[model samples]
Target: MHNPALDFAVNKENKTITIKREFAAERPLVWDAYTKSELLDQWWAPKPWKARTKSMDFREGGRWLYAMVGPAGEEHWAVADYQTIVKHQQFIGVDAFTDADGNINSAMPRSTWDVAFVDKGPQTLVECLISYDDLAQLETIIQMGFREGITMAMEGLDELLVSIKK
Candidate 1:
């Protein structure tokens, strides 16, 4: 697989995690990979952890429910509640840990995500801004290895895009 062009930063002042990445695919293709469940399943999680969507509706007020199954067969459920969608351009949503039955887990940190897909001729640049409720919550996730996990997941996305391009 080709190396991923990705940048991950945590802003202390804004209390947010921002990830910037460039993919060889066009904006529409990148957008589809994000909004379409089947496409997301191919690259959403890190290796040895497959993503399975329980249900998805790609629109404002809609939700994408999924689970990340580990090599040991452990499943971690999560849900993304969409707040705004701008077709192949951008989308904003709130993500939270949840149960298989779609019940939120209050003990987990929740994050608001703003994802933008910028057209760059034959390539697309994806910027993701993730905000936590507070510094404590932010620290919690960072300590949990969020950065490494997301970096690995984005590399998976890079691989998926390369396969599609071929």
Candidate 2:
């Protein structure tokens, strides 16, 4: 239940995980959910886990804070700061865990999450790139439940993409 097989590529320096799915919908619709807070709250985390955002300023120099509720009734707080935002194209941000008050927790390793949207004919390509400094950080992430969590989270995203009720 803890470790799962994640579709990814591991280089000598870092691990790169990728998921490419065609959304029956168009690019704009898929892009909006990633940028907008209301849509993101619908299916950001994996199922069986729930989250609520405290703040979401989706712009350069902006920040978003959220709390994830675990299956065992535990809560983990995470915060992300937007560094660069290119409309309808890309979102580059630094992610970290923090307290409910949104204080930065240094214990959690910080990394940049790069999300890009590319038009695939009439469909959309939602590419998520996560980068770390070196191999050790990559291992740390894997040991910290990264593979299982990302797989579950991406599956949730895949469901949202194929759903017509969005």
Candidate 3:
């Protein structure tokens, strides 16, 4: 598949969503794009919805708080609480919709994200496994257009990766 193509799958029974894509960049670069907020801000959100990091602590038990700003200047905040981080290999975290103060929204679904970066010579394979609290929660977010937004974000990442490779 092309770098812009993603293998997106959902498992309602397992309460999980999986997204796989390959980038024409080294594993280290891909890892950095994920771990560093500076790089993340470049491509984390879909076009016209920029990601702005408020704070990032890249460590186990730490948090990365950010907002997805709309073209009209509206903002939606979220927080990722890192659970495990293995440099250049894998990272696991929980992401939840939150207020600007980083308080998790109990009314919304929370998802655990398990991300893996596999070295493939000049390229890297990125896999993201997102597990929700339940099947209903998974459906809820999917119905809310998570798949389309995230697919667009991944494509944005592909464009960034291509530019950085130049």
Best by TM-score: 3
TM-score of each: 0.95, 0.83, 0.96
Residue-level lDDT of model 3, residues 26-130, one tens digit each, is 999999889899989999999989999999999999999999999999999999999999999999999999999999999999999999999999889999999
How big is the positional error of residue 134 in model 1, measured in Å on the Cα after superposition? 0.7
Candidate 2 lDDT over 21-55, as tens digits, reads 44545688888877777777766777788667889
Q: lDDT per prediction? A: 0.91, 0.74, 0.92
Instruction: By lDDT, rank the candidates, best first.
Output: 3, 1, 2
Where is the poorest 10-residue window by lDDT in model 2? 1-10
Q: State the lDDT of candidate 1 residue by residue for 1-166, as single tens digits.
A: 3235678899978889999988888889999999999999988988889999999998999999999999999999999999999999999999999999889999999999999999988888899999998888899999988988888888898889888874
| Candidate 3 overall lDDT versus native | 0.92
For model 3 the TM-score comes to 0.96
Q: By TM-score, how accurate is candidate 1?
A: 0.95
Clashes of 2: 0
RMSD of each: 1.8, 4.6, 1.2
